[model samples]
Target: MTLSDASSERTRVYVLQSRQPLTTDPAHAFPADRYDVVVVTDGTAQEVLREDVQAGPVTVVRAARDEWDSVVTSMPPDAVEIVTNDEYCVAACARLRDVVGLPRRHPTNVDGYLDKVVMKCHLAAAGVPVPQAVALDPVVVAARDTAERAVSTLGLPVVAKPRREANSRGVEMLEDAGAVQAWLARHDGEPGWELEAFVSGDLGHVNAIVRDGRVEPVQAGRYLGPLLGVGEGRALGGWTVPAGSEWAARAHALNRAVVDVLGTDGDFVVHTEFVARPDGRLVVLETAARAPGAGVSELALVHAGVQLEIANLRLQAGLPVPVPEPSGRQACWLWLPVPPGRRWDAARDGARAAELGVDVRVRQVGREGNDGASAAVGASVVLVNDAPGGLARTVDAVLNEPWFRAHAV
Candidate 1:
């Protein structure tokens, strides 16, 4: 059908964006011929929209995060779809669906995905293996007692995490009762904290597309190290598990169980992380109702033909999701956080990456320090190879290089 012929019958889709999409051309995700698309983003995102998209049929509207409710309520009620891939905006999008009189397209227990304490409770109730967690209210005078109680219950070396934050923003590891006490005292009177027993196992994640409660597993991979290690100057990276591998099957099954327990009544992309214990048991660490960060979605695009973020957008817009086919190439991605007061020297990093003699795609190069945000990406690298262990070995070689430090200004 011609673009003009389909315009009159197009479904109105409103995409809520908090950051620039990983897709080079987001407009292509929602074809102008089939969907009338409007992107609702903040003022900061205006400049990032590509020029062609700005001149196309898709419309752009500026609405700050805090002002989303007002902006959503004022939107024309005829809008058929509301979509967002941002972690911070998931709950808001769920609530806004009601204001527009649209049928609930998100999980009924949406809070379970937003709050760690609530999420663990739901998963535990469903007989899913999750870490034993104790919720903590901010305490002032009784901080020591509170810390001692948590340690006594959950054991020593607990992980203290903000219940609602994402990207490991306020996560801390307390090795002893005294450390927990000190950590608690520092954040006195702050709310929404929880303590869970630290699970020592291989960290891995699975990304999938869910439609009508059926999960189509996309890709599963093992992390080089814990995400928390990134703050200690460790380079975070992971390699995709080859199709039909034992780890892939186990990860996919665990991901399926998580979706079933989490109430998968709607269509969306689910990002799940789990710890594979040495004894062959998989314990879900946490799950999100949106696309994952750290170039994972892009890695999926490389390993499989499906880009999860784009699939997420298409699902929300009532468009058909593309089936993923293995590309016969294993993919690995790395993120190097620029240290404080240092800038990313893309030229030098590119030069170093070329020495590895593999396909190294530099996805992003941050020119300024990332300010210690665990979620920030100072530089990103993607490597794909057809050999069985080529990607993993190249990832190791990339990590061993002093690229970030050697190019220090």
Candidate 2:
């Protein structure tokens, strides 16, 4: 147990958190006692990261594109940079390459998903099924015959998402041209849209870690309930993990081949969405080269038995570990249950905070729906255990509960 013994010693993994560790409880993997550096950039996730980095000295720095040069240069020359924020994604890499250069592992064509149109094209060309998609800027698409043709040809029930959006931001599901027009108006204020042929089926997902030359499944299952999107006055409702079999296996195999074809097996994590038809066909929605946001880190650890934080640590140390087997357990990352206009006072309401582990998030106040109360927020995570081929439980536990308050104060 001696700290001097390298075998038992915890590896230095910077659970680099810009917003949060994408987990309710990051302590599950890189516990403070084991992880060396837990760097929090800025925002609610940073606050949570700071709380979780208690095992060692936590460094809270306000890092920006301009500051990256001085920051990386200040750190130990060998210290590897683990990136998190999407806004500064490109800049983070550029700064790292210019400063502490070498051995930064990331997903191949990671930027493709940033553009919805590009993602569709790539998947379609690879023979990987995806929703019929087109790039539309409203007026831009209205002007171009080709773009206009896609708009006219694309069937109803289309979902328009900004190419650069995350967490369902600026995402709108439309049934006809009117909805499309309203959505296009919004897109004018944001990035161009990727209007996709929305697939109808049971919701499900697969997140895997690809290291060296292998793609290992971390969490795969159905989305028990509804997938929430952002609204004018409130933050979008997040997704809960479910136990779905039909698409899970097929998605893993499909993603495995897709990853192989893309040549991104070197060092990275992947999150792919899918639809399971009653006929047993699996359609891939889209994939991200980076780790899945929300509380996926814990799901990867508890269900897949893949220590993403540890793997990331090993990766940072230039040491790779073998992929482990998935335990087929259900796990999730849920937001605080607080409703819009409501606020979380963890100190004054200990029982409430403990009860609603995944309800509260900090962003509720920033948008149109917020009631305007400001204090940091937190989330929760659950890991299920299964015996043999059976699943632990339905994702309903994670989605439906008094622990998660659906109505905001």
Which candidate wins on TM-score? 1
Per-model lDDT:
0.74, 0.53
- Distance from true position, residue 48, model 1, in Å? 7.4
Tens digit per residue, CA lDDT, model 2, 220-299: 75554345532322222223233345445676787776576455634666667778766766777766665565555556
Tens-digit per-residue lDDT, 1-409, candidate 1: 1113234666666778665443334666777666766678774554434221224444677877777777666646664667777776687788887777776667888887778888888888889899988887553334667877888899979998888877787889989888888887787777788889998899999989888778888999999888876655677888799978999999998888888877787778899999998898889888998878766877889888888887886676556777777787788877776554455566776676677654333323355444443434466667788887777777777777776452344
Distance (Å) between predicted and true CA of 363, model 1? 8.9
Q: Which 10-residue span in candidate 1 carries the lowest summed lDDT?
A: 46-55
